[model samples]
Target chain A: MTAAALSLSKIVAGHDGHVSISDVTLAVPAGARVAVIGANGAGKSTLLKTIAGELPPLGGQMRRCATCARMGYLPQSATVDTRFPVSVYEFVAMGVWNHVGLFRRLGPAVRQRIDAALDRTGLAALARRPIGALSGGQLQRARFARLMLQDAALLLLDEPFAGVDRPTREALMALIDGWHAEGRTCLVVLHDLDLVRQRFEWCLSVDDGHAQLTPTAELLALRPTADGAAAARHAFLRDALRA
Target chain B: MSWLLDPFDFAFMRGALAACVALSLGAAPVGVFMLLRRMSLMGDAISHAILPGAALGYLAAGLSLGAMTLGGVAAGVLVALAAGLVARRSALREDASLAAFYLISLAIGVLLVSLKSRNIDLLHVLFGSVLSLDRDALLLIAGIATASLFGLAALYRPLVIECADPDYLRQAGGPGALVHLGFLLLAVLNLVAGFHALGTLMAVGIMVLPAASARLLCERLDSMLALAVGNALAGSIGGLLLSYHLDVPAGPAVVLSLGLIYVVVLAFTALRPRPILTSEVTA
Candidate 1:
């Protein structure tokens, strides 16, 4: 049996006095592939942010394994500064920073790992080139290479496929599928339902401030909500509160 | 060559040149990180905020570089701490707090300078004199620059990663926050070190322009830092020579040289071939 990677008990998180997401309880068993889906501002990103430790939960106890350093997070495309002057190789090498710390040199094994990561992501050919010099599809590939090097037990991706071309997208999904095959857990925040089911094994549908463990089949069975997600989460929260 | 050759003939000119070279070398890489962290304005704020300390140093031990520099570094660090606190505590924005820092420091500096020195001496304080520099200043600047270089060489990756992506850094459970504040402290200390040659206003350019120009040309952080340090050294030397030959002020001259370097970088990058991929971002 796989260990649990993340467990949040009755967590409440928000900013500026208003709770964005509250009273959410979820446990992501290690190696489980889960997708979070909802309309905009269903607290999907907020929840992800809190879980990623970018922001602390406003309420509740959140606990994790002490060796949880093997966790990877890819923020939304907008939050990243895509204009830094780094080569594809240099950028991907950064995935080892947690282990590197300050004032340490990368050993040959680590270099080999970085090389393997880039190759795994289908970015080996692009290693020598400038990161800024890559096309949208190519850049995403480079970022994915970094993710691979993290050797993370769990992967959290926020819109990884955004702006990527078609062939490259397939390649990326294949790479993720490969990770899933290796028994690593992944929680991907994706926009496409077709890709979600085709690639993911579990679904976490969030509406209003609440998310549920609906089987992937059920979310696929129930169509995307009407009146958008912000309202949907509210209505869903109201119903859950009454129940 | 004569411009370089003639400067060594005079001890003060030699001292100014050596000090400027050293200060620029260290400040260049520090500036690169400063630009990456979006604290270019903060660099300026710290430089100016150190004025009262420099003034206090002069008041205590007379116009000795040792006393004044220590005082200045202390004051600059205090202002940075204050700015950090104010931005966190008050509704005022970071830039606004920096502005408050600038005003208060400037006022205190003016009051101190008025209490002792004449107006031209204060002018020399704001804008350094080629004639007043000595071998002691040169050695001090050299020591500071060398130490900064060694520190930067050791910490470049962590620093670059801190600026490039803080989210992953936090998830990775590294000391991302402390490292970030350390980077800010580096900026303050570097600015205080460069305060004499570059002055407060022009010091930031000496720190920022070379890095900015290098950014246009390079695709890697290490290479960019290397190029920036080279650019700063070359630019300051060029400024010193031109100012010496043309009889212009040295501080403005050094900055003008960096400005001209940026213009050249802009033009060259426009004409140069970029990497084949579409978007280039650092990690």
Candidate 2:
């Protein structure tokens, strides 16, 4: 049996005293590409935030196995203040904070790594450009570059492909595939059913106040894509209005 | 040359110049961070919050620099923490809570000052006596400036990450809250130091105006920091000279100099050609 990278026992999560997802118990297997799916306001982010340790879970316990000690979290693009005065290279170089931290110079090896990450993300030419000047797709690519440089064991991505161009999305997906090949665990919050269906083996469905972890193939097969897509769209509109 | 050199001839003028220059060194960078965090107005609120502490210190120790500085730092930090707590726990947003607290702080501070001290002493606390800088005030300002620079250096990486993407910092187990609290403490320290020369009303002026001006012209953080500090240094010297020659109050003159620089920067950026708006392009 594969070792569990992350384990959550009857976890209850929320923000600012309001509970969003309750009794979410799951043991995410090492190397599993888990897709987190839900309607708007269904606490998808709340769950991810809890696992990433950004928000403290209101109840229950979470344990990260020894191998998955380091975690990388990519928040939604809009949540980042891209308008802050920083170059793309400088922003991406921050990923080495784990190693270089404060006071240590970004030595040659780390500089090379940052350069390689930026190059892979196709941001080499725009390295010196202010982050604020990047288009949505470019900024998303910059974020991915930073995440790559983070060299984390577990990656939690929130809507990573949202507002990104198809080509950029494909490139970023390739990066994730590379990490998956290296046996890194990824919990991705995604809205694209096709991508989730094609790429992910497991799904953590976050519905109104509840969370269920299931096999993606089984879940999609039981409902099929068309009906599931319609229901999701309906729920999105309903939740939008309620919010 | 003599007109410029004349202000430095007096020991008090020399001391005041040293104080202003040192205050700008620390305050400008703090201002740049504050502006980037979108907490520019929050500085104003915090400066007002320092008032009651300074007042209480004056009431207790009667114009002792150490007492006022200690009291100001304590009061400033308490209000900051209280406001943060209220914002986190209550429905009101951070800015709203800070606004509410600062208004109350300002009123209490004025009331406290009027209780024991006469109006003349109150004026000294409110406007500051920059022209009469003594040894202890000079040492305090210099010490704060040196400490602030080192603090900012130590906190640079976490601070930048916190400002740009706070969630990522928290997720990575970086000390985001501690960095924020530390930054606020640095800001308060700089404000307290500045109040010795510019008064509470104008202390934040040194912090914000040059930073706001720099933001218009600079596209990089390092450049912004350099430019803001440069603007502040110019403002300090120019304002001191203006006060000496024009016979105006030095504190307001210095702040007004920084403000003038801001207006000039605003005008320069406004007149410069901007990228053509997408809406203006005809297909």
Candidate 3:
């Protein structure tokens, strides 16, 4: 078997000793476009954060191939404070800090890469504006621009399409498709099951603090039937009407 | 020209002006970071916390600059660390813990002052004698300003990244904790330096007010920094002149001048008509 891009065995992850996901064992093949799906508060984000090394696993063994050394993570948009006085260009330039480190000058080549990333993400013209002033979609695009500059072998996205419009979502999905074509490993946390089935080959279903990894078709088959889904929709509408 | 040149005619006046300029240059930039981080009151708390240390130094070695600065830095760092610990370990929020610690520190400082020092010395500690600054005080202010400028330059990128998104910085392998502690140390250093000219009670006034005023006028970070420093310098010069002519206290005069600038800026912006839709086409 080809070496797995990422492998986690019996992992327990969360913050401050409160484990959100427990006993998660899975291995993702290299170049797989995997979708992580679950209801709200199901620890999907916690799993992604652990894989990205943002949160340490309480108990687990995680191994990554040498080719997957460079990993990029895009946290949910709500986690960033847009009120800070950073320009789009300056914020995107931070993606290069891992390579350049502190005190290294942004030479011509680095500047070119930053500019190219901004241009590709459609943020070149708004480069000088403060991030606080940008709309939500624009800010998400700027974040994508920063991710483009990362140029990682593995990418982890948490709610990447949350609160985004259709065109912007399509544009972002196209970028991910390009990354997939280049054989980069991607694990995306998403809510739309249809989109996941359409785009991803594998699915990791997280529910009740456990994760089940399966092919997308198999996972879709395990989802609730049409009558159950309709009942869930009706219950949701009733709650909304009562509110 | 005479109005400008007259303040420098006397050695004492020149020394006072130099002290003000040095304090402004060093403390204002740190103040900008404090404002951006929404820790403006933390500066106030640390300034108060310095008082007990200064009092201890006075008790040990009377009116010694090195001793008092050392004492103040130690006390400030202790309070910061303790408050941070309490906030992290307990249910109390950081600001609430800071308030509690600083109040206790202030009471202790006052008790220490009453126990050992005379009223004349207490007055000096409460309100600095800017016009009577000796060469030692002048050197201390200049040295701190120079060091702080270099320190800020070195920590600028990490500090900004940490403020923007600390988790992202950590994921990118930047030293977030080191940058945070270094920034706190710099803040304490600048506050100690300001105490020589503005005194512990009023030192934070000089640091925060000028930065606050500049925020209303400038939109970019670099511009805001430059404007804050400029506003501080202007307030210092204007306050010194006012104290000379009107015979008011110099420290409050300087801080009040900054406050006046803020009010004026507020009024000016309020009167100006705002644009309805300022968004422009990008590309």
Q: How accurate locally is residue A172 in candidate 2, as Cα lDDT from 0 to 100?
A: 94
Alpha-carbon shift of residue B77 in model 3 (angstroms): 1.3
Which CAPRI quality tier does the interface of model 1 achieve? Answer: acceptable
In order, what DockQ does each candidate have?
0.43, 0.43, 0.35
Sorted into a CAPRI-style docking class, model 3 comes out as: acceptable
Q: What is the lDDT for B81 in model 2? A: 87
What is the TM-score of each candidate's chain B when compared with the real chain B? 0.90, 0.95, 0.94
Q: Which ten residues in a row have the lowest lDDT in candidate 1 chain B?
A: B274-283
State the DockQ, from 0 to 1, for candidate 1: 0.43
The local lDDT score (0 to 100) that residue B254 gets in candidate 2 is: 90
Please give the lDDT score at residue B210 for candidate 3.
87
Runs in model 1 lying further than 4 Å from the true structure = A1-3, A65-69, A217-243, B1-3, B84-97, B267-283
**Model 2 Cα shift for residue B164 (angstroms):** 1.2
- Which residue runs of candidate 3 sit more than 4 Å off their true CA positions? A218-243, B275-283
Per-chain TM-score (chain B), model 2: 0.95
- Please give, for residues A1-243, the per-residue lDDT of candidate 3 as tens digits: 756899999999899889999998999999989988777888999999999988899998999889788888998854466767788899889888878878888999999999998888888888998877677888888888888778899999998999888888998998889899999999999887668778999877777687867777654454434223423533343343235
Candidates by DockQ, descending order: 1, 2, 3
Share of reference contacts found in each model: 0.69, 0.55, 0.36
